[model samples]
Target: MKRLKLLVTLAKKGAIGEKVKITLRELADELGISPQSVLRLLDEMEKEGLVSKEVLGRKTYVEIDHEGLAFLESLCDAISEALYNGVIIGEVISGIGEGAYYVKQYAHLIREYLGFDPYLGTLNIRVLFPKTVFDALCGVRPVVLPGFTKDGRTFGDVKAYRIRINDIEGAIVVPSRTVHPPRIAEIIAPVYLREALNLKDGSRITLRVVKG
Candidate 1:
């Protein structure tokens, strides 16, 4: 799994199509191993038909074979499905005009915890079975945004659950720190989710909350 992860990281960083040109030293540095170790690993991978590489003048041009890519894709699919699978159907709606301000204020923590800088506002959705889902989230660990002091007042801590809506990775933001009804949920993503997902108010979408 670590070897495969290294290959995927290389592909993302240096690959164009199926081929990537990276040095043994570079790969070793990225993987935090010695060049000799990386060469041994690559030799093993090559023997197993996971990668093919040719050394040319201190640079190694590597190619992940079709079999290797297929294997990686299958692993990715399984992991994604496992990480995101609490089915909740919801309809988009407008918020109470506080989402933008709060999101802007909390943008730094969102990026740190969620791996994306969310847009200025959130996409509010009126969820079906809101109580069941909310209660489930309450029982699980969440990505916590610690409360901070701003403008002489203290902002309360917020909790988030990893979710993917319409295949876009985001989170179900439960700010129980504030007064919010159980019927509505807010989603935050890197992009303006409604525009990115081509959605409008009244459009129904699915939220897959991550299993605890």
Candidate 2:
């Protein structure tokens, strides 16, 4: 588990295909362990073909090996399957009043890729789970809404995951450049979910992944 955690940490630091210069002390600090323990874990991972390390002068560079990448991908698949087979619970929350504007901006793309014309606004939910709501979307493929330039303004790409809430079909939209935290989910559906479901702040909701 420590080796896997180390690999995940390295991957999060953008060390998948390319080398990332990191120190044992920095890694130890991040993992909350001693530098010697980190070194031992790295040695084990290296022997298992999970990572590659190189040294230059006083610098240490590390990268995830192919096997490491494969391992992470498999883990993601397993997590996704487990999440899909179950359900995630969250509480209704209010947004910063930007959902309507963003939804209107990507209306066309949402209709094209998500197969529905979303309502004017979104239903914000604060996921109460292991951590980020993204945990439920581990290996699931998302419908990518390409960014566009309009009226001298540029919009970033968005990723949409199909979901079902109380038997109502909807989607969770995640903007590439977003101010929202990982625990917050912005949902879009064909109708106003708040009115349709009679929801309010602190209302608990269940979300189920709809596999395509």
Number of backbone collisions per candidate, in order? Answer: 0, 0
Please write out the lDDT profile of model 2 over residues 1-212, one tens digit for every residue. Answer: 77888999999999987999989998899899999999888888989999999889989899999999999999998886665463668999999998899999999999999889999999999988636777777667888999999999999999999999887999988899988999998999999998999999999988887766
Name every residue pair that clashes in candidate 1. none
**Residue runs of model 1 more than 4 Å from their true location after superposition:** 1-85, 130-132, 135-138
lDDT over C-alpha atoms for residue 201 of model 1:
90
Q: Which number leads on lDDT? A: 2
Q: Which one is best on TM-score?
A: 2
C-alpha displacement of 142 in model 1, angstroms? 0.8
Please report the TM-score between candidate 1 and the true structure.
0.56
Q: lDDT per model, in order?
A: 0.78, 0.89
